[model samples]
Target: MTRYLEGQTAIVTGGMRGIGLGIARRLHSAGAQIVIWDLAVDGWDSVANGFEPVMRQAVNVASLASVEAGFKEVVAQQGRVDILVNNAGINGPVTPCWEYPPAAWDQVIAIDLTGVFYCCRTVIPHMRERGYGRIVNVASMAGKDGVQYISGYSAAKAGVIAFTKAAAKELAQDGVLLNCIAPAMVETGLMAEMTPEHIAASKAKIPMGRFLQIEEIANMVTWIAGPECSFTTGFVFDLSGGRATY
Candidate 1:
């Protein structure tokens, strides 16, 4: 491993487990300081045993105030945040849109979509002032191709894809670069939240005949959040196993 990010610091929302955890571990292996932000992270120490200097903070991404406070705390301690991975999102409910509860829809939008907006809003100024930063928003293949029974998740992720593009353009002149990843149904704990039928349908859609692996997402993110990804921003990098045609 090349320790390319030797002195950089990275914040991974929902990083205590699953895909987020995989990404955090990979970034740490590359020598970037790791910060995990989640609603509850009780046993994080056991999982992050080798991650020396790993910091954990309680962050409810749905709240703008919480996002602001979390960013402030990271900056106050680390002096600066060089990378941010917005990976804290829910799968929402497995139900038809017509039958979806309004509250559930709002919650999905809040965490998956608006939450990205809030974090970026809070960090953009600081990154802009420093003239260097990297932000990787985790989106989904469902956002590009709507999945049945997961309308809320689909819509929210679509919003994330658009948000990444728009924000990247605004920061083009600055050293801050923003990009998003749209992965197919990834094998993670979040899949447990989906119905068997929903999972089956999603898997069948992938040309590779398998769900995406967490490490695959982590690999893509490692490069995107690193210094080599200089010329690309405002783009959606697909990890769909041939599911994404566009």
Candidate 2:
């Protein structure tokens, strides 16, 4: 059987756990070499099984220096990066916009929005040089609908979606495709931070009346990361389970 992603190298930020882990597993199953860039180094060993000898890098996505150093190491080890999944993010504090903390806001923006930019900015040149690349940024439905009490997270994810569009246009002619996925609530560690009331409210909003499974998101990402996804750059793929109106 010919693997769809054989011989490709992929970098998945926050790949140590949760949705990112699911993505890494799927891509690896498709035969891509996995490099997980995350702050949690200990979990890599468990997730590394069955992948093509996964590379683990302890990276703080919020810092450009950290991202640069991590990517440099990735290049040193793998020699190339064919796909990038910008999946690192934090929900910050769940509070009204007026009550949101400045520090918390900055933290969310740094990790969820600016971090994606940093990864793209660092890897895009390499992708352009190679004349091939697939970049997937993970945004959220909150970005589109502006969920109440999570202003910081919503705004940051919105920025990610916007950035994906702008960057995709800039690189459209360069053979490097960039797109983002806006998913509704998923059952991940991030949900642990939300109050039960908040979780229930989010579920009620989804027409499907359920949280998305990680594998569903992974399957969508797998397709988007493959060659068959050609000609679909600069767009947002909705994974909202009927919650997204646009």
Candidate 3:
């Protein structure tokens, strides 16, 4: 079978583990040269998956300087970036909006919202210069529905969704398609940060009555990052397991 993404280069933020790693694996399997960008590179060498990133760089996506340096390195090594999956995020503290810590809220916004902006700001020029690119921002259903007690995470994700749409429109004719996915609860390391009550409440809201599998998310991302995802820009793909009313 011909690999659909042959010779392409993909950068997956937070790719050392969780949903990001799953996306990296799927893209690598589809023939994209993968680069894992995260704050650490530990545990990746021990992952059982046969797939390995062509390169791994420690990057703090929330810092524009760090993002710029990381992308500079990627371009120097790979010559070009064909796809970017902005999947790095934190769930932040689960608390009522009024009672949420300022520091915690800022942290979530910095990583989950500002980080995506930084990555896109740095990568778009490269993609525009090359006349091709695909960007998938991993948002959440919480962004749309506004989960109670997780105001920081929900607000940041909502920003991501809005940013994706605006950026897609800006790059519409530039051959860079930008989109976002709003997935319901997915069982990932991030879940450990959530309260048991929050987790239970989230699952109960899902019509599917279960958390999403990593592979299911990876499958959607694989297609979105490929050339076949043409004609769909500035759109939000829902992976809410029937819980999304909109």
Candidate 4:
């Protein structure tokens, strides 16, 4: 409503749906032009059509080549990217560490953690040259508290949290603030990947006794992606609804 981000452009990875779509809509509402990078899985066109003039880029965040090419296309069209929300990720199979398939673990790490690295590695330089930027990564509270039966997901997200801190320090003086949000379970399609028991267990851990709304995560991310969040970098903001105090 404030239009604080007016005249800026933002790229939201995996922005076709779920948490990524929520953040893209929020940034658009704040007056930033939206560029959605997604693999454009089935039924994606209908979702893309619902948005107001969103620039859609078919992208697979897990691949560095795809990420690089996507970044180039965005710059070519938008001129510059003022905000980047690295929200693309997948929750690997819900299984114990011992039972977790090695390939599943690698896949999760590639997309959830390594994808962030690829995006940051590609964009930081461009942002640094511009002398200003805001990047918010969507992490998870599971990374900190370590939820059972989701070892791959937990480890990948933990890596994301740590990655944010380390990158933020390097850009502290460069006017490029990097931060991440560690949210508890949210009411997103991502839950479809988990079993009912796992979902219930996650919700029960929240003191609020409820899952997070997509708009709530969007609200926090919008603020962090704005100029007002100038003082903090390399920090993890909590959106766990009292499940994680740290």
Ranking by TM-score: 3, 1, 2, 4
Supply every candidate's count of residue pairs whose N, Cα or C atoms clash at under 3 angstroms.
0, 0, 0, 0
lDDT by residue (1-246, candidate 2, tens digit) is 357999899999998888998999889888899999888777445534445445888999989999999999989988999999999998888877999999999999999999999999999999999999999999999998899999999999999999999999999999999999999999999987889989999999988888999999999998999999999998999998898888
User: What are the runs in model 4 whose C-alpha is more than 4 Å off?
Assistant: 41-50
Against the hidden true structure, what lDDT does model 1 obtain?
Answer: 0.91
TM-score of 3: 0.98
Higher-scoring candidate on lDDT, 1 or 3 = 3
Residues 100-203, candidate 3: write the lDDT tens digits: 99999999999999999999999999999999999999999989999999999999999999999999999999999999999999999888898999999999
Runs in model 3 lying further than 4 Å from the true structure: none
- What is the TM-score of each predicted model, taking all chains together? 0.97, 0.96, 0.98, 0.96
For all candidates in order, the CA lDDT equals 0.91, 0.91, 0.93, 0.90
lDDT tens digits by residue: candidate 4, 112-134:
99999999999999999999999
Candidate 4 lDDT for residue 96: 81
Ranking by lDDT: 3, 1, 2, 4
